[model samples]
Target: MAKGIRFHYLHRDSGNYKKFGHRDFSNPNNLTVEEITQRIRQALIDTEFFYPEKVGIPKFLFHRYGDDFSWYEFESVEEIQTHYLHESIEGFIAKLLRDG
Candidate 1:
């Protein structure tokens, strides 16, 4: 089987980056969307459990709250096949069960 890809979700944790670090997401001075996204992608790779297709980061917060990360699980990649255009965690799980 081809290895699954992990996707990391991200957002500001604090008002500024002082508590976290210079490159922290919460830092007002650190306004780099590409850099932030890159960090998230890196985190996902480090974790290596979640799949990118099943994960999403909406332009606007879907479940607006603290921490700014959410995750779903799958048994196989087929569960994630149709999510490119229209995907959700629930669909991913359902498709996973349906395929197997």
Candidate 2:
């Protein structure tokens, strides 16, 4: 069986990073990386879970293992698009699901 990938929303303050929440696909097999990315982008824009006046835009991070993970701090949609083009969803997910 294949492992699933998960993403966590984080907030950084004075060099400290804390997890606020996470988005995990209930049926990961049916969801593609593009879909997940789009969902995350929408979440960022909605800002319903964040207080911009108090905390600013939050950072996004993904991990499926204790040590294997990637962090992204995007300022605009263009940057996210660029990252998607350069990073393969399969590869990223594979890394995420890898065990230490």
Candidate 3:
């Protein structure tokens, strides 16, 4: 499991990515697939309203980089939730380890 995950939002004011929040899960690899999905859902709740600079398209994502600096971009909460149902934990982990 990852040591931590960072949540970023494309800021409306500066038009750049800004760190909003993060979590350091304790033994995330031990978590069941459902537990992982639920945790992500709860974290994303109402985050669209976080640190708004102007009314525009929501550009929020959560990502975690491995020691090699490879990361996977989860474009939205809905996309994350949907993928979890169809993808295996091993496959997801592989993507996290492989993608940037």
lDDT of all predictions: 0.30, 0.37, 0.32
TM-score, ranked from best to worst: 2, 3, 1
TM-score of each: 0.22, 0.32, 0.24
Q: After superposition, how far is residue 30 of candidate 1 from its true place, in Å?
A: 2.1
Task: List model 1 lDDT by residue over 1-100, tens digit each.
Answer: 2222222233332332211111101222322444433433334434223333343322332434555443322221111112133333333334323331
Q: Which residue pairs overlap in candidate 1's backbone?
A: 17-27
Q: Tell how far residue 79 is off in model 1, in angstroms.
A: 31
Candidate 3 residue lDDT tens string, 1-100 = 2332222333322323344423222333545545555543343324233222121223344323222211222333211222113334444333333321
Off by over 4 Å in 1: 1-25, 46-70, 73-100
lDDT of 1 at 14: 35
RMSD of 2: 13.5
Which stretch of 10 consecutive residues in model 3 shows the poorest summed lDDT?
77-86
> Positional deviation of 5 in candidate 3, in angstroms?
7.8
Best by lDDT: 2
